[model samples]
Each structure stands twice: as structure tokens, then as C-alpha cells.
Target: MRILIAEDDPSIAAGVSASLRQGGHAVDAVTDGAKADAALRDTPYDLLILDLGLPNLDGADVLQRLRKRGTGLPVLVITAREGLRERVRVLDLGADDYLVKPFALAEFEARVRALLRRYTSQGAPELTIGRLRLDLPGHRAWIDDKPLELTAREFGLLEALAARPDRVTSRAQLVEALCSWDEELTDNGLDIAIYRLRRKLADSGTQVRTIRGLGYLLEEVKEGKESEA
Candidate 1:
């Protein structure tokens, strides 16, 4: 998943970003609400970790604007406010969930997982494509019950492809999925990752097909011949 963390505190932002990345998510961190809003507008993120007390535009206002746009992007607000009214106000303004400051990392991650599950896959943690099985939570992939040693980027690429098996996933979308603002993936980089991923999945009864000028597709391996599509 690609996530944007809008937080002013460097320590908290770094910690949360690290944890999420460790969980196989691409994350971008911003220190102010204006930058956060800009990033939100420019990028397509699976989730947003927003801090209510922001510099230029407050978190509540940000949430309100996002909702006003009818985006329906799942937003998890983080605030130091413990008042019930404040919580309700943000919820009313379209914050999907809230977490008070000084919270446990485990709990924070759990909340993130819950939100993602609810919004992305209806609580399902595994995605299967023929003999290929991707354990979303565990960040692992397997073929015929044997595990494939995939790098983080490789796993992310596989997940993106497997999300819509046999459908064309454009290079732009794949680059977005594998990169954050801090890390940029060039066309060559994406190609290398795809090549490595294909090699790993060669015998897994699945194939990553390049669609010439289009993009890539994950499909069931043909028995005797390759597919031109």
C-alpha cells in the first residue's frame, strides 16, 4: 500500500514510516498540512495518516476539504486531542479513524491494518493467482506451498500485478506503487524489478507478460506456448 503521513514531529513520523515500510508499504512523510494537502492532491495513496494540529491548514480542515472533494480515501487521523467532541467533530468531517498521541506502535499498526483491510479487501489478507499465493500481512509469496524469496520492491510489484490478475497495469501505476516522494523509480528501475520478479516466478505457474506499448499483465502460464497478448 502507498501511504502519506502528515506529521510535524520528526520522531513520530520517522518511527511510523519505518514501521509501515517494514510491513511492506510505500510511505511518504510530510511535516505540514499544506505540503500534506499538496501530496494528497498529487498522489494516489491507499491511506493517509494525518496529524490534526498542522501548520498552514489544520488537520480538520484538510479532512473537510478531502471529504468535500468526495474522494472517499480512507483517512486515519492522529491527534493529541482526547476530548470526545473533538473526536466526533473529526469523524463527522470524514476522518475514518483516530488515534491519540503517545500510543503504542503495535496498536497504531493494528489500526492501520484494520483500516486498510476494511477499505481495500474486506479484511482478506491473502491474494491468490493460480499457484501463486501472496500473504499480504506477512509480506510473503509462495508457489505450490514453497516460499519465494522476494525483495521488498519485488513483493510490491507482485502485489500490484496480482491485485488485478491478467489485467494491464501501466508502468506509471507500477512506478507509483513502488515509489514514494523520497524514492523515485525510473523506467529502467521498474524494468529491472519486473525482470527479477519474472525470474523468481518462472516456475510458479504464473507469468508476467509485457504488452508492448501498454504495460504488464500477470496471467496463468500457458502449457506449451507463450501468449502474445
Candidate 2:
């Protein structure tokens, strides 16, 4: 999934972004609340990790504006403010979960998974597209019961394509799903990612097909056809 982190502290932001990337998520980060709010408005994200002590616009105001806009996006607030009233206020502002600073990475990740699972369709954590199986909480994908060796970006790519198996996933959609703002997706970079994914799934029952002008599609491999698109 794609996540946005709104934090001013570089250390904390880098650490959290690395952890989430290791778990197969595409993460973008902003150092101030204004940029955070702008990213939230422009990008499609599955979760938002917000810090309260933000410059320009505070995280609470960000949350307030978010809710006022009627966006139901799940938010997980991470902050140094440990007061009960602060927690209550943030929750009242529409944060799905809150984690105080000095939190265990394990616990933080668990909260992320829980929120994602809770909001997923029918609350189903596992996504099955033919022989390909995805465990969102576990951040793993398998084909024919065998785990597919995939990098974090590749996992994000697969998830994005699988999210719309019957329809074409546009290049912009894949870029949004797989690349953060810092890691821009050039045309060659996109082609390399797609080539790598196609190579890994070559022998699987499915294939990634290039759609010429549109983008790409994931479909079952037909009999008497080339495996790679």
C-alpha cells in the first residue's frame, strides 16, 4: 500500500519510511504540515502517518481539514504529545489510531496493518486473484502456494495491478502506487520494473500484458501464447 508520513524530524521520518518500505509499502514523506496537507489532497494513499508538532499548519488542523472535506482515509498519528487530553483531542479530530513517540516499530506496524485490514473491502485481509495470493498484513504474495521473490517496489506494482485485474492500470496509477516523491519513476525505470515483474511471473499461471497506449493488465496466461509480453 501507499502511505504518507507528515513529520519534521528527519531521523524519525527516515526510520519510519525505511521500516514501511521493508514491509512492501510505497511511502512519501513531507517535513511540514502544509506540504503534508497538499500531498494528502493530491495523492492517493492507503494510510497517513502524522506528527502533531508540525510547522506552518499543525497536524490537528490537517486532520480537521481532512475530515471536514469528508475524506475517510485512515490516519495514524505519531507524536511526542503523550497527554490523555491530547490523545482524546486527536482522536476526536478523526485519527484512526495514535502512537506516542518512543514507540516500538513492531507496535507501530501492527497498528498500520490493523487499520488497513479494518478498512479493506469486507474487512478481508487476503486478496486472491486467480493463483496469486496476497497477504496485506503479512506483506507477502504467493503464486501456486510458492512465494514470489519480489522487491518492495515490485510488490507495490503487483498490488496495484491486482487491484484492478479486469481493467487497465494506467501508468500514473502504477507510479502513484510504486514510487514516492523522492524516488521518481522515469519511463525507463517503469519499464525495468515491469520487465522484472514479468520475468518473475513468467512460469506462473498469470502474465502481465502490455496494453500499448493504455498501460498494463494482469490476466491468466492463455494456452499456446508467449509468457512474456
Candidate 3:
């Protein structure tokens, strides 16, 4: 999962970023509403953690603008305000969830998981393709009920591919899924990740096939074919 944190507090932003990264998500932090809005406009993210006290354009205004622009991106508003009106205002302005300040890290993480599950999986916890299974919340994958060990990038690649099994996913789309604005992913970087993922899935009866001038596809191994080239 990719997330953008729009917070003016350096400490809170850093802490949230670390926690999200540790939880196997790519994260980017912006300290002001202007930058936050620009980041949202420029990148694709699974969620946004926004603070209402942001500078250079209040966070509520940012949310309003985003909604006006027809972006249905899931937003979790973090604010110190405890008033019902404030909460209702943000919710009415299109924030999907709200967290008051001084929240426990555990609770925050749980809320994040809940929101992601609601939006991304629509209540489904696992994705299955033949003998392969991806545990979305657990950040784990399995083949024939055996655990599959994979690096973070490789797991992300697999998740993207498994989301649409057998359909060709372009290299550009894969790169967007694997990288944030701060991280640069070249064609070679993507190729290396694909090669490593293919090797890891070699014995799982699942194959990641290159589509020549296109990108790649993930599919169950065909009968009589020992491997994918």
C-alpha cells in the first residue's frame, strides 16, 4: 500500500511514516497543505493521512478541493480538535475516517488496516489464483499452503500482478505501484525485481511472463510446460 501523510508536525509525521513503513507500506510525508495537495494530484496513493492544522491552505480546504475535483481517494483526517462539529464538518467534506490527536499507535494502525480493507479488498482478506494465495492484511503469500518468502519489493510486485491475474500489466503501472516520488525505479530496476520474483515463484506452478513489447503477466503454469521463458 502507498500512503501520503499531510502533516505539519515533524515528530508526528516522522513517527507515522516509520510505523507505516514498518507495516509494509510505502509512505511520503508533506508538511503543508499546498504540497500535500500537489502530491495528491501528482501521485497515486492508496490512502491519505491528513492533518487539519496544515499550513499554506488549511487541510479542510484541501479535502474540499480534492472532493470538488472528483477524486474519491480515501482520506483519514487527523486533528487535535475534539468538537463534534469539527468532526462532522470534515466527514461531510469527504474524509473517510477521523482520528483525534494523542491516539495510540496500535489504534491508529488498526484504523489504517480497517480503512484499507474496506476500500481495497471490499471486505475480502485474501486473493487466490489457482494454488497461489496472497494474504492482503498479513502481507504474506503462500503456494499450496506453504509459506512463500519474498522481499518487500517482490511482494509488492506479486500483489500488483495477483490483483489482475493473467492480464498484462504494463511496466509503467508496476513502477507506479512499487515506487513513490522519492524513489526512482528505472526499467532495469523493474526488470531486476521481476527476475527475482520469477525465481522465487519458480516452483509454485505460477509464472510471471514477459509480454515482449508490453509488460508482464502472471498465470498458472500451463499443462506440459515446465517453466516460463
Candidate 4:
């Protein structure tokens, strides 16, 4: 999943970003309210970690504008404002979840997973098609109960493809999912990753079918249906 951490404190942002990256997520860390707002407007993030004490714009205003834009992007407000009423205000302001400072990274990661599942996975931790099972939070996949080893980028691509099944997911969307805002993913890298993924799923019931100029899709390999590049 791709996530944004809108935190001003450099150390805190680094800690949180490292944790999410270790969990196989692409994370973008921004230090100000204005930057956060700009990022929210441009990037498609799976989850947001926001701090209320942001400079230039403030977290509450950011949340308000986000909702006003009619985007259902899941927001997890991480702030030091510990009053119960404060929590209520943020929640009412459209924050999906809130966490106080001095919280455990483990708890934070868990909350992130919960919010991602709630908004993106329909509250399901896993996605299945035929004999393939993808543990979304764990970033592990299995075919016929055997593990499918995947790098972070590979898992990301597989997740994107799995979401639509037989429907095409555009190359641009796939690139956004696999690369961070700062990184560049060339066509060669995308093709290499897709090739390796195909080799991994060769014996499985499902396969990644490329749609030439359009994009790629994951679908069950039928007996007589030919797959195109």
C-alpha cells in the first residue's frame, strides 16, 4: 500500500515512515500542513497519518478540505491532543481513526492495517481467487497452500492486479501503486517485475495477462482462451 505521513517532527516522521516501509508499504513523509495538503490532492494514498500541529495549514483544516473534496481516503490522525472531546472533534471531522503520541509503533502499524482493510479491502484481511490466497496485511501470497515469495514491488503489483481480477488495471495506476512520489519506475523495471511474477504464478490457476497498450489484469487461465501481451 502507498501511505503518506503528514508529520512536522522529523524524528517522528522518520520512525513512522521506516515502520511502514518495513511492512512493505511505499511511504511519503511530509513535514508541513501545506505540503501534506498538496500531496493529498495529487497522490492516491491508501492511508494517511496526520499530525494536528502542522505548520501553514493545520491538520483539522486539511481534514476538512479533504472531506470537502469528497474523497473517501482513509485518514488516521496521530496527534498529541489527548482530550476525549478533541478525539471526538477529529472523528466528526472525518478522521477514520486517531492515536495519541507516545504510542507503540506496533499499535500504530496495527491501526494502519485495520484502516487499510476497512477502506480498501472491504474489511477483509485476505483476498482469494481459486486456490490463490493473498494475506494483505502480511504481504504474503500462497498458491495451492504453497508460499509465493515476492519482493516488495512484486507484492505490490500482484495486489493491484488481484484487486481487479479480470479487469484491466492501467500501467499508470500500477506505476503509482509500486513507486513512491520521488522514485521513477521505467518501463523496463515494470516489465521485469511482471515477467518474474508470471514465472512465479506459472502453475497457478491465475495468471497476469497483459493488454498490450492498455495495461495488465489477473485472471484464471481458461483452457482455450489465448492471452495477449
Candidate 5:
């Protein structure tokens, strides 16, 4: 899962980022609401962990803006406020889940997983990029009529990439998706995974393209098997 952590406290932000990364999720941590809003606007994230205390803009304002723009991204609010009214307000403001400050890391991770499970089960129960299709609910992938067997890591990489098909995802993001914060994941490990996944995807005539210096994009092939524009 790709998550956005909108936290201002340096220590707390680091801890949250590390914990989420350790849980095999790609995380982008920001210290202010403006940066957090910008990140959400530019990227396709599976989940969001937002703190009420933020600079340049308040967390509530950020949530309000996102809703106004009709971005229904799943949001998990983490705040120090422990009042019943505050919790209700955040929930009513469009947050999918809430965690009080000094929350247990295990609880936080569990909530995140729960939200993702619910999100993936909705819609068509499948995500598609041209002929490539992933049955999110069934945890299956297909290239039109053929099933493509994929390892856990490969499947995770495919979901992260194929979720926002046509967009590029960085190597660092994929590394975080495959390995937790404490895991010693080398760049080569990601490369190897990509190489294996590419071979698996070859049958679809769709390829994972490397953009020289930036990252990778899962591109579908045209009738002649040419890469998508």
C-alpha cells in the first residue's frame, strides 16, 4: 500500500514513517499540510495517515479541500485530541478511521490493513490497465484469458504499479513496498523482482518500462505489441 503521512512533529513523523515502512507499505511523510495536500494531489496513494496539527494549513482544512474536490481517498486521522466531539467531527469530515495520539503501532497497522481490505473489495473487484487485470478481491492477476501466477512480492509490486497505470513509480517506493523498515532490502533485490515480474508480464504483450533516470511504468502494448504512448 502507498500511504501519505501528514505529521509535523519530527520525532513522531519519523516513528510513524518507520513503522509503516516496516509493515511493507510505501510511505511519503510530510511535516506540513500544504506539502501533504500537494503530495496527495500528485500521487495515487492507497491510504492516508493525517495528523490534525499541521503547518501552512490545518488538517481539517486539508480534509475539507480534498472532499470539496471529490477525492474520496481513504483517510486515517491521527490526533492528540481525545474528545468524543472531535472524533465525531473528523469522522464526519470524511476520515475513514481515527487513532488517538500515543496509539499502539500494532493497532495502527491493523486499522490500515482493514481500510485497504475494504477499499480493494469495492468497485468491480478488479483493477484493469488495458488487457492486464488484477482481481483485487480474489488476489489474482490475469492477462486477458490467462492467469499469471505471481509471488507475494511481485503481486504487491504489480498492484502498486498497476493501480495508477500510465504513471511512473520510483524504485524507492517499490523497495518500501517489498521490504519493511527493519528489513535490509538492497536495490538489486527490487531489480530482480522487477526482472522476474517483467518476464511474467511478457505474455500479456504489456511491459514494465524503465524511464532512464526516474522510475518504472507498466505500459500496455498496442495491436502490433508496441508500448503504450
Candidate 6:
């Protein structure tokens, strides 16, 4: 998952970034709301870990603007503002979850995972298409009771595909979801990732079908059957 951490405090930002990166997530940390907004506008993020105290536009304003433009990016407000009213206000402004400062890294990680799971599953943890099962929080994928060995990128791709089964995911979107800004995302890179994922998930009967003019779509490929498209 690609996460944007908008925090003014350097220590907090670095800590959050490192923790998230170690958790196998692509993180982009910004110290102010303006930079955060720019990042949001340019890239597609699965989650946003925002601090209320921002330098430029303020966290609330950034969120408000995003919502105003109909961008429903899931946001978790990580702030020191523990007051009841403050929490209520942020929630009202469309923050999906809130975590007070001085939190344990484990708890914070759990919260982020939970929020992403909810966001992707639309409030459900288990996403199933045919016999394939995806446990979002557990970061596990199963097919017919057998677990598949998938790299983080492959797992991310599968997760994204499972979120909208049978929906075509453009190469660009898949690249964004699976790679960080620093990674070289080429057409061949996506192809290679898909190839590896397909091989590992052979038994699952899930195939990454390439649409001639569009992109790739994940669907159940019957045993001994192939996609004509």
C-alpha cells in the first residue's frame, strides 16, 4: 500500500515512515500539508496518515479540499489532539480513523492495517471471489485452503485486483499500487510481476487477463481453459 504521512515533526515523520516501510508499504512522508496535497494530487495512495498540526494548509483543510474534489482516499488522523471535541471535528471532516500520539508502533501499525483493510474491503476483512480468499489484515491469500507464495508486489497486485474482481486494472494503476516512487516502473516490470504471480498462483485458477486495448483484469481461469481475449 502507498501511504502519505503528513507530519510537521521530523522525528514523528521519520519514525512513522520507517515503521510503515518495514511493514512492506510504500510510504511518502511530507512535513507539511501543501506537500501532502501535492503528493495526493499526483499519486494514488491507499491510505493517508495525517497529523492535525501542519505547516501550510493545515490537515483539515487538505482533507476538506480532497473531499471537495471527490477524492475518497482513506485518512487516519494521527495527532496529539486527544480532546473529545477535536476528535469529533476531525471525524466529521471525513477522517476514517484517529490515533492519538505517544502510541505504540504495533498499535499504530495495526490501526493502519485495519483502516486499509476496511477501505479496500469496504468494511469487510475477508474478500472472496470464487474459491480465492483474501485476508486483508493478515496479509494472506488463499486458494482452496492452500496458501500462495507471493512477493509483496504480487500480493499488493492481487489485493488490488481482488478488491474489484473482474474489473480491469490499468498498468499504470497497478504499477502505482505495487511500486514506490523510487522504483523503476516499466511495462516489462509489471509484466514480470504478473508472470511471477500467475506462476505461483497456478492452482488457484486465477488468471491475469490482458485486455487488448485496456489493461489487465484478474479472473478465474478454469483448469485446462484459456482466455480468448
Name model 3 segments beyond 4 Å from true: 186-188
Residues 129-177 of candidate 6 have per-residue lDDT tens digits of 6577888656788887988667777787787677667789887778777
Q: Estimate each model's TM-score.
A: 0.89, 0.90, 0.89, 0.92, 0.65, 0.86
List of clashing residue pairs for candidate 1: none
Cα lDDT tens digits for candidate 3, 1-229: 8899999999999899889877767788899999999988898788999999988989999999999999878999999988999899999999999999999999889889888877775568887765788886567899888999988888888877876666899998898777766788888988898888888888777889888998889888877777674
> Residues 50-153, candidate 2, lDDT per residue (tens digit)?
99999999999999998998989999999999999999999999999999998998899889989988876557888776577777666788887899889877
Worst lDDT run of 10 residues, candidate 6, spans 220-229
Candidate 4 residue lDDT tens string, 84-202: 89999999999999999979999998898888877766767788875678987778899988999988888999988887766899998888888776788898999899998888887
Give the C-alpha miss distance for residue 10 in model 5, angstroms.
2.0
Query: Which candidate, 3 or 6, would have the higher lDDT against the true structure?
Result: 3
lDDT (Cα, tens digit) per residue for candidate 5, span 1-229: 6678899988888987887665546678888999988987887777889999899999998898888889878999999989999999999999999999898888887787677767874645677766778765345788897898887678878876776577898987777666533455688888888888888887576778888788998877767765422
Deviation (Å) of 131 in candidate 6: 2.7
lDDT of 3: 0.86
Worst 10 residues of 3 by lDDT: 121-130
What's the true lDDT of residue 26 in model 1? 93
The window of 10 residues in a row where model 1 has the poorest summed lDDT is 220-229
Question: What's the lDDT for all of these models?
Answer: 0.86, 0.87, 0.86, 0.87, 0.79, 0.81
Whole-model lDDT, model 4: 0.87
Off by over 4 Å in 5: 121-155, 161-191, 198-229
Poorly placed runs, candidate 2 (over 4 Å): 222-228
Question: What is the Cα-based lDDT of residue 72 in candidate 2?
Answer: 92
